[model samples]
Structure formats: C-alpha cells, structure tokens
Target: MTERFASLMERKLPMLDRLAVITARDQYVRKVLIPMFSDEALDSEVRTAFQSGAGGYIYQVDTLNTAELKLILQEYSWADIIEGEPQLFTQVFHVVQHSPDEAFRAEVLAEIGPYAERGEIDGQEYALMYDRVELAAGRQQLYGSQLECLNGQFDVHDLKDPEGVDARRASMGMQPLQDYLEQGRALYGPC
Candidate 1:
C-alpha cells in the first residue's frame, strides 16, 4: 500500500473494531435472543433481560457508530476510500446499514452506486444498502438483500420484480435469493 493508503487504513481501525464487536452482538441477537423469544417456554425474566441488555447494546452502539460515520462520510467519498480491494470500505457500508438516518443512508446509497459499478466497492454491499434505502422509503427493493423476522418466520422484505430478483442479485455479485434467505434462516430462524 502507498503511504497515504496505509495511513487511511490505520485511521479506519477503530471504526472496524467497533463494527466487529457490534456484528458479533448482532449475530448473538439473531442466533440466540430471537430464538429464545420464539420459544414458548422461555422464562419471562430471562427474555426481558436479554431484550433490554442485548437489544439496548445494539441500539446504543449503532447510534454512536452512526454519528461517527456520518462525520467521516462528510469528509470522505468513495474515491477517497478506494484501495487495493473493494472491502477496504466495508466498515463504511456496515455503519450506513446500521444507521437510523434514512436520509443519510439514501445519500450514501446514491454516492456508492458508481463505485459499485466501477468495482471500487463491493456490489453486494451496495445492493444491500440499496435494498435498505428502498425499503425505508416504503418502496420495493431491487435486490432482496433485506430480510425481516416476523413471529418465528424469516423472509425477504417486499421486493420489486420478484421473478427476476436472482438476476438482479447476480449482477451485484450476490447469491441467489433462496440462498440468501436460507443463510439468514440459518442465523435468524426459519424462513
């Protein structure tokens, strides 16, 4: 890496560290907390503790991370982040994904499309964020990357042109819809 690239990478380490911890906790919520809540026999006290503790952690961390990321994005663009690999900016994507600021996410979504097309950012990441933005606007997602868990069942959010969703996902370097849903099911429960 060039000196500048190395310096930028070093600067991203703290954000990456935060993303790693938040992701592990998110996985725990999906893999453990959700299932525990689904169980008809789960103890009320245990469920309440996990709900307030784990759920609150995700909320708090995402809030802080989102605020930091918004300032970072204001100072940088996709061009500034491009390095040897598209994943150099994965932390940015994850932060935007978790951000509650729909307007900011939408702005980043627009800014990243060209980068994804140029292969400077991961297309799958772009697709995922695009789906998130679209869904937040109460519109159908072009790529069915966003999933929801209602009750004990998991499924893709409303998708546009469902019949050709796999084709759209493929163009974005994503797995087929069924495979994506199945993977989410593996982590989050039955689809």
Candidate 2:
C-alpha cells in the first residue's frame, strides 16, 4: 500500500477491529477478513464467535473440513478447487463516528504502517482501510448529534449526512468479499 493511502487511513479511522474468516472447499481455499468495518450481521458473527470463546477473531479451517462452504463457492464458480495461492478477502461496511485525537491517530498509524511497509497490504487494501475508517467516522458523527455532544470529530461530509450514509451502505452491500476478491484475482492474478 502507498504511504499516502496509509496516512489517510490513519488520519480517518483510528480504532478498528479486524476479523479473518477462513473457509475451504475441496482443494480451493479462501480467507475472508472484515477490515475494521462493521455490519450488523458481521458484528453479530464476531460477537458470537468471541462469546463462544473463539480467540483472536481468526477462523482457520482445512479444505477437507468445510464441504458445504466449498460446494457453495463451486456453485458460483468464484473459485476452482485446486491448490494455488491463498486469496485474501475482506468486507467493508457501516460507518461509525471517530475522533481525530492526535493520540488515537498516532496509534492507528503505528499499527498499520508496518504492514503496509512490508507489502502485506497494497494500495487497494489501504484504500479499503480508509474507506472503513470514513464509514465509522460518519456513524460517530450521527451518534454525536443524537447525544448532543461532539466527541468524535470528522470533516468528511459524505459520511455525516443521511443520504451519504445510505449510499455508503448500499455500495458495501452490493458486492460480497468473495466475489470482489475473485474478480481481483482474475484481473491481477496472484497479487
């Protein structure tokens, strides 16, 4: 990921929760990650998984173990059941309000910078990181107004307005992470 994009994400969304869901079908493998974004359904899964004592929010599975998941992917032709590079997946959703406090921003930058520097994340991933931060910040803005307090401050107007929020949610729901990653893999091959 470009330094510019990383900087943006740090400036926007400082607090984030990352969830990685792994599934396998036959010989094909996939990993779905929720990149600091929130959706009711996704949140519920995370919460339940956590409450049920799943540690670290990472789900790992063998291709031979999840026959149903593999079958589902095959049905959509999103992946071929073959040994190959593991695909990275993530879904971005739900905007929440966030504070631009210097300390908070610094902490976020510290956490993400190393990964970007190592090439573990690319420009697109950086962009998605920023997008999730913006969405969260937007939600925080709404909450602030409802509470009659301005705890979290953000200047991105698109996320603060109702129309913008609806638009953002719609866009997020339009594509599943599996589909998005499949398309990207097809276009770019193993990134």
Best by lDDT: 1
Report the C-alpha displacement of residue 129, candidate 1, in angstroms: 0.5
Steric clash count of candidate 1: 0
Best by TM-score: 1
- RMSD (Cα, Å) of candidate 2? 17.8
Residue 71 accuracy (lDDT) in model 1: 61
lDDT of 1 at 26: 40
lDDT of 2 by residue, 6-65 (tens): 774464332121212222221122223322222233455564454344223222333223
Worst 10 residues of 2 by lDDT: 90-99
Once model 2 is optimally superposed onto the true structure by TM-score, how far is the C-alpha of residue 56 displaced, in angstroms?
Answer: 23
lDDT string, candidate 1, 94-149, tens digits: 76787788998899888878777787778889888988999999999999888886
**Measured by TM-score, how close is model 2 to the native structure?**
0.22
Estimate TM-scores for all models: 0.75, 0.22
List per-prediction Cα lDDT, in the order shown. 0.73, 0.32
